[model samples]
Target: MSQPTIRALILDDYAHNAFREAHIERPQPQAHEVLVRVVASGVNPIDYKIRSGNAPYAMPELPAILGTDMAGVIEAVGADIKHLAVGDEVYGMVGGVRGLPGSLAEYLAVDADLVARKPKNLGFREAAAIPLVFLTAWEGLVDRAHVQAGQKVLVHGGAGGVGHMAVQIARALGAEVFATVSPGKRSIVEGYGATAIDYRDEPVAQYVNQHTGGKGFDVIYDTVGGQSLDDSFAAIRLYGHVASCAAFGTHNLATGSLRSATLSGIFVLLPMLTGVGRKHHAEILGYATRLIEEGKVKPLMHPQRFSLGEARQAHDAVEQGTGIGKVVIDIA
Candidate 1:
């Protein structure tokens, strides 16, 4: 085979305004990593935050490539990597933070344990969108809440990125799922096999009374956070569990305390940022792969697709909420 040159978009600085394309030497895999030919990269809100230099916790050195999730085909495997080999298609949240190189390139030297075989049922675009959101949802619903059959589960922002995944995961786990959404998004939540509560048209107490018959949900997931998290406290049953991926503000704990409820905060980037729990992310995605192959989970793709060079536009779509679901870049 001829020598390979990596084509990547590099951001020189926060004020650079755009990613400039450049061809550099291809990277070789390390002891525990694999060389992947990137086919697609998922555009997320954090991508824009880091691109604009807001997410310091999730960005690397200057002129970095900033993509969190990618799906690609393996070109070569490191000597120590045994589970994956050349020609294998895979996906994962590889990097873009903590001095680790990101995935907005023609290739990635991905940690082997951070990646799983891409579900045979999903294309590169759909698979590329699965990592961060899916891991967040899985950590909240399954790991923290211990969601089980016959439980009453409520997912806030049910039509959103993590919200939609939580809804489907709850359904697949045999929980009776209810989702809070705006009137316009009721159909979207309901389409995922959950009952949709119009947060605007109904008050928290009213929905809690009507849906749970004044009892409350066994588990409540707050993907929206802020006031939604307060509502979650009121909506949860005595000794129930609540999980929030967007927990950032100070709030009164009396509501949860009075009910003896427990709240779990989810920050999925801990693994990537610290490198301590990286394998769990890969394991969660492995489960998602099965859920996807079984037709129990699906990606809600954005209407507009992007090219490798239009990453800025893709980031805008995600940040502005102009896209229907996920905005993905076609890298290959």
Candidate 2:
């Protein structure tokens, strides 16, 4: 008998209008994999970037399924998977990059180490909105910056995907969190339990002085890279740490070096691209699940919803930044 088939959105080319829907054969789980019926998938900047051909480094072969975040119920578990079982709800940054099949499909056979039990408090869409951004923030703040209680943490681009998560993660880690957002987005940062700074209203040093008595933040997280990274270097206290998930452009290290500070770059896709370090991604998601259950962290979701076939619309929403929060695609 033939394997079961499922519907999916496929990108046949690097064009904005390339998403096409069709049915494909379902995948079988490997020894270290789990087969999941994806209920929802998260739309992220990278998804749009790849679709527009702007992210050549992340380019996948044509006719590829393109999505990075997903939450679903496990349909089956591989032989080596001792913890997960059929009917378990799980989520993760399973694929959608390199040659790996992404989550835009109805079903996925993902590495067991990369899949984690979804937070009981969140539905599939909310859980889908998390993994990538949550992992990016946690890796930068918890793993790299070593955030601690009472430390002054400043997150740049606080209203953005990773920035929002960073702000909440820092606050949950017992830090005095502050986020730099536009005046229009002040409420968003404030809603996440962070002190809001209108980035447009003051210079970095001015806010640094007002917020920290000119001592600078003990930790700076720049989710908006480029110039924001430069500002982060200036805003960090002496010997403090700075981390960024979007540190893609050329950077000057003089200010940070002069202050004896450390800067760490977070590329959350490393695990999906390479076979190594996948377990850490799963571990971070587990921690995020706890934060979710504790009500300390929640994925900021946009009000609009899309179906699996509406991949282009979801990508457009993220690219245009027209959505209130994370744009999600319902698959199941």
Candidate 3:
């Protein structure tokens, strides 16, 4: 029998207009893999960077599919797979880089350990938006920082893709969460059980003192990196821990050193890029699923929807910063 064909969003070349719908070969699961019939895919900044050939990592070769996060129902399970079976709903940060076909397709063959059962409370699109951002936040705040109840946690860029997840994860772990966002987004941040600080008007030190009563946040999660990360070093309490996912600029660590604080940078792609720690990614997704099912976490979705063919427009919304929440592509 011949294999079925699948519709995928393929990037034919390193051009801004390269993403388009294409008929591609549907993949079959390997021994430790699962074949998923993708219902939705999430768009992130990395997608556009890879599309433009500007990302640090090597592209998957010509005519590559361009997505990392997906939510779908399992269609087939490999011989070695046990935890999941056919028809199980799952989501994960599978493929999209390093020669692997991405989730922007109607089907995906993904390593079983990289995926987790989706929350029964979430639909395909909402679950699709959770994996990447939730994994990033979990690895940094829960795994690395070990955020505890009563610990004061500060998340920069609180309304962002990863930031919103960080805020909720910290709160779920019983931390006193504080997040920084624009004045207009204060209510959104506050709604997540975080004390919102208006970044445009409130200096880091001011909010740090105001919210923490001059003790400073015990854990500072920098989702905005760059100058925000630098500011985090100063805002954190003495001996506090700082974790950044987007540390891109040259900054003096002298402030952190003087305060006796520790800094850790999170790169969620390390597992996908190096093939190490893949199981932990799956575990984190499971944690996120539980949080969602318990109503402790919810995905912040953009009002608009994009089809696989309109992926470029989705990318544009993320780049332009007008997207209110996670941008999703309907892949069914």
Score every model by TM-score.
0.97, 0.98, 0.97
Clashes of each: 0, 0, 0
Candidate 1 residue-wise lDDT, 74-116, digit = tens = 9989999888889999999989876778889999898898899
Q: Put down candidate 3 lDDT per residue, 1-332, tens digits, no spaces.
A: 88779888778888654777777778989999999999999988888888888885746787788798999999999999999999999999998887677898999999998999999999999999998899989888988888999999999999999999999999999998989898888888899989888888888778877888887789999999888998998898889999999986788999999999989888888888888999999998988889898999998999999988888888899889886999999988
Worst 10 residues of 1 by lDDT: 54-63
Candidate 1 TM-score, true structure as reference: 0.97
For model 1, what is the error of residue 215's alpha carbon versus the real structure, in angstroms, after optimal superposition? 1.2
Model 1 lDDT, residue 283, Cα: 90
Ranked by lDDT from best down, the candidates are 1, 2, 3
Q: Report per-prediction Cα RMSD to one decimal.
A: 1.4, 1.1, 1.2
Please report, as a residue range, the 10-residue window in candidate 3 with the lowest summed lDDT.
15-24
What lDDT score is found at residue 83 in candidate 2? 92
* lDDT (Cα, tens digit) per residue for candidate 2, span 74-162: 99999998999999999999888887789999999999988899999999999999999999999999999899999999999898889
Query: Which candidate, 2 or 3, would have the higher lDDT against the true structure?
Result: 2
Compared with the true structure, all predictions reach lDDT values of 0.91, 0.90, 0.89
Q: Which stretches of candidate 2 lie over 4 Å from their true place?
A: 15-17
Error of 3 at 189 (Å): 0.7
Q: Could you say which candidate leads in lDDT?
A: 1
